[model samples]
Structures are given as C-alpha cells and as structure tokens.
Target: DNFLGTLGGPGITVPVVGAAFEVGIELAAGGVEVNLVVDASSEFRTTSNVIANSPAGRDDRVVVVGAHLDSVAEGPGIQDNGSGSAAILEIAIQMANQQISPRNQVRFAWWGAEEAGLLGAQHYVDQLSPRDIKDIALNLNFDMIGSPNFVRFVYDGDGSDTPLAGPNGSKNIESVFLDYFAAMSLPVEPTAFDGRSDYGPFIEVGIPAGGLFTGAEGIKTPDEAALYGGTAGDQYDPCYHLACDTFDNISLQALDEMSDAVAHSVMTFAMTTSAVNGTDKGKGLGKFKSDMEYRGSHLVK
Candidate 1:
C-alpha cells in the first residue's frame, strides 16, 4: 500500500507512507523484463477561522508586526516558523515587561494556516474596512530567521535591485534594516518581494511592508558562502519542510542577530512611523499611494 500527501493545495501527490516496492529484473544473455503497478487515494476539505491578536493602546494609528504560527504537516516546523514566532513573542513580552508605550498602537499577530497559501493573513486583510486599512501605518513581517546555513536577507521593498517592490513608503522601511546591518558591519542581501509569506496580504493592499529572511530551500551560492561563511552548495535550510526541522535545526547565531533586528524594527516603528510614513509631529510628510500596484512574481512557498 502507498500513502500520499498533498502540500498546500489539491491535485499534487507525494509519497508519504508505506514501504518502498521495487520490481526485480533478471536478464539472460539476450532477454530482460520487468513490470510495475501503482494505486492512490485522496480527500480534500476547506475550513475557516478568525485571525487572533493582542492589541496595545494608541489605536488612532497602527504598527503591525506579524509571524505565522502554524507549520507544514511534514515536520514539527520549528525553524521554518517557530523561530519567527518565538522571536516575535519574546519581543512582545519584553515590550510589555518594560512598559514601553508607543505613539501608534502596536498589534502583534500570530497568523495561522500560512503554509496553506497565507490564508490567515489574507483573511484578516480582506475583512478590514477601508478606514481600518488606511489607519495602518506600516507592517513588518518576520519569517524563517534561523536557517542553519543562513544569509541575512531583507525584502527588496524599493524594487531598486529586485523585480518586486512594495508601496510608496516601503523604501524607507527597507532603509531601517539596511542601516542597522550596515552599522553592525554585517553583510546583507535582498530577497525578492515575491509574496511567499504573510507580508503578501499587507503589501497587496499598499501597506508599506518589509521583513527579514534567512534563505530557505534555495541553495546558497559560492558568493553567498564567501560572504556568510556557510557551505556553498547546500540549501540554506536543508531540513526545510522535513522531519529534521525540529528545535535542533536552528542556528543560534543567526537567531540572535535576527531577533535583535526584529526588536530594533519594532521599537523604532512603535516610537514613530516618521521614517516609514514620513509623518512628523503627527503631520503627514506626504500622502501614501493608496493606488500603488504590487509588481512581482508570486513565490508560494
């Protein structure tokens, strides 16, 4: 018997259970023969739910930070998302413990079913009113920040280098992270704005959005290895979506740096959306491009 599984969609089949079956071939000096047979079964269903969140005060304007909380069924998904989820949770806890207040409300979200095509984040955005959407100052997403063989990858918000770019104010958001890495004397690379994660929904609605990524199933190049000191030919996270993606799959060094960067971004935006939205002393520096279009190839991880 064979057990097959489909990831994030219908129609695709992958072997998941049962023993390997092979047909042996025997050859005489002039003749050889072999035969094989296969069978499969599948079921599909759909469900819905509300996205959960904890809101801090100062609701007139909002600074949203998010990470997906669920993982693929193939593995525990510790590094694929547990790394981002845990880091954001700690940041939220510390902010509360320190009693840090912000000019704009900070809403931390733990999105669900992201691996199933960003369902959670998209649902949240789709349900929002126009006014509600306009009130958002910006969004910062964090995903897969602890790949064992890592590269410090930031979203290409400005599209200056990559084909994808975010809304009008997104360049400013990217600058914050770029500036931080530069000050730390750390090398960084730009990941395409390919809408592979939760940030997709936010950017689709013209929200100034940016985030961090330490590569995933993508192979690291010799150039990246030279800059980041990891094996050139290996996937950034060899265990991605596999049973080995447990707590032990993470890289602490990469996690520490990324967590700090997350904290810095959260705190910076909490204090002011000036750099992000160009608002000063509660006055707008310029209007946000509500009609801004999303330009990029979608990479559905």
Candidate 2:
C-alpha cells in the first residue's frame, strides 16, 4: 500500500504483526515558504445512540429520559456528564430488575456525540415525523448532576426566576423537583433553561422538558455557597472539562441528593396519565419554536 494507517478501537482486533507506517513530518522556517507533508493518522469513525424503550400499559404517550454518554477530548469528564449518565443508567437497571411498568411508554436514551455539538440528540429529533414528535409527552434530561461544589439547580420551567421558559407543562416538571426538595427541607435554586444540554433538541421542537443540574463552570454565588455549603465565589465544578474530572472530583453528597430527585421525577412522570401540554396525550397540533436560545456543548459556560 502506498499510504497506510492503522485502524482499530474497542471491540475490533487488529493483527499485532502489522508494520507501522513511517511518519513523515516536515518543518520549515516561520517566514520561509516550503512544501511540507506529514503522515498524520486519520480515519473515519462512527458512533450510535443507545435507546431502550418500555411500552406503555395502555397509553401511547412517551416520556423520554436522556443523558449524554460522551466526554470532551481534554478529559474523562466524570463530573461534567458521567454523573448524569451513571444516575440514569442505574435507574434504568433497577426499574427493569424490579419489573416496574408505567402508564406511559418510557424511553431512555444515552446519546452519542453530545459533546460534539449535540449531534446524536439532534439527529434523533430530526428523524422523528410530526406525529412521532407529537407522541412525545415530555422529556427529562439530567446533565452534570453532581459537581464538587454543587448547588441544587432545578430548571426554571415557568421563567419565574430566569427570563427563559419551557413549553407548557414544563412548569409541572419544575414543580416536581421544587416540591421534592421542599418536602425534604432542602434549599433549591433555579438554573436557566437555555437548552444547553441534550434537552436542547427536544425543546427546540416544542416538547415540554425539564431536569436537574448541580453546577458547572458557573461561579457559585455567595448566596448559593451559603445554601449549598460550598466555597463562595468558586466554580461549581472546578474540574469541569478538565483531566482532573475523575470520580474523585465528584461530591458524594451532591450525587446522592440529586440522584434521589432524578428517580423521584422519573417515577412521577412515568405513572401520571395527565397531558403535559393540554394536547391529546402527545397527539398535539404541530411543532413550534421554543423561546430559549439553543446552545452547543462547547459553547456553554
């Protein structure tokens, strides 16, 4: 072969006896122009989204629970998103183990390439027919659920705290978390629902959505520090998007509390027969635009 490059990853096995191609890297002076050729390794790669669905006992409405199962290139992204993915996967496994059924079909999606500009989640949404889109009653997304200096950040579904709001019935989802924390005597704060995570795709097409976030690169205000007992003026996640975001970077207390709320909200929507947006159990008229701005993973603060 004239130009050769090795190709192997995860489950694929490459023969050990193959010779590595000689790398040709050329360098030239900063101002002097010269022809340069480098044998940089390259290959086309592909990834797929993981989706599990449980059929509804009677109703056809669907409640989609989603989390991104990817990390940035710079780090392991443990607290950035591993926390969210872990919480939901455990919930899914336990639900199957217990053989629990819900009135509405529950779809759990571990999205691929979310850190790559929400590609997987957006592709899933883009492929849905209008009827299919309408069949989705609501979406619950969990991202960055446990930061080291975490705050209990529930999305402002009704826009009372923030300027942005979700589609109708999103307030109900927000209320679910608020009520849960209130019952436990925990202080809560509302985070702007600006479609920063996987939920961005769902809400863009008018699907009512809401979820929990502990915190990220955003600085922890003095009031938030007082409430959550973390350092004031420090970032909610000091290791966010960094190589230091290993399991050790997570706060066990934040994970425990946020995960409980995640389960509570999931179970609440699973059993409820009520329509999220006053539509006939997801068979709404059509899709519409959300008022919030859509944000890419890398672009988010």
RMSD values, in order shown: 8.6, 10.5
What is candidate 1's lDDT per residue for 212-246, written digit by digit as tens?
A: 99989999999999999989999999999888999
- How would you encode candidate 2's per-residue C-alpha lDDT over 1-301 as one tens digit per residue? 2333234334445443222343222222245455545554344568899999985443357889999999987789888788999999988897888788877788999999887788899999999999898889889999998899999999888788898888777777887788778877889998887767999998889888899999889999898887789999899999988889999999999998888888877777777656667532332222222221212101111
Query: Given candidate 1, what's the lDDT at residue 242?
Result: 86
Worst ten in a row by lDDT for model 1: 292-301
Overall local distance difference test of candidate 1: 0.77
Model 1 alpha-carbon drift over 4 Å, by segment = 1-57, 273-275, 279-301
Q: In model 2, where do residues sit more than 4 Å from their true spots?
A: 1-44, 279-301
Instruction: Tell me each candidate's TM-score.
Output: 0.78, 0.78
Give, for candidate 2, the lowest lDDT window spanning 10 residues: 292-301
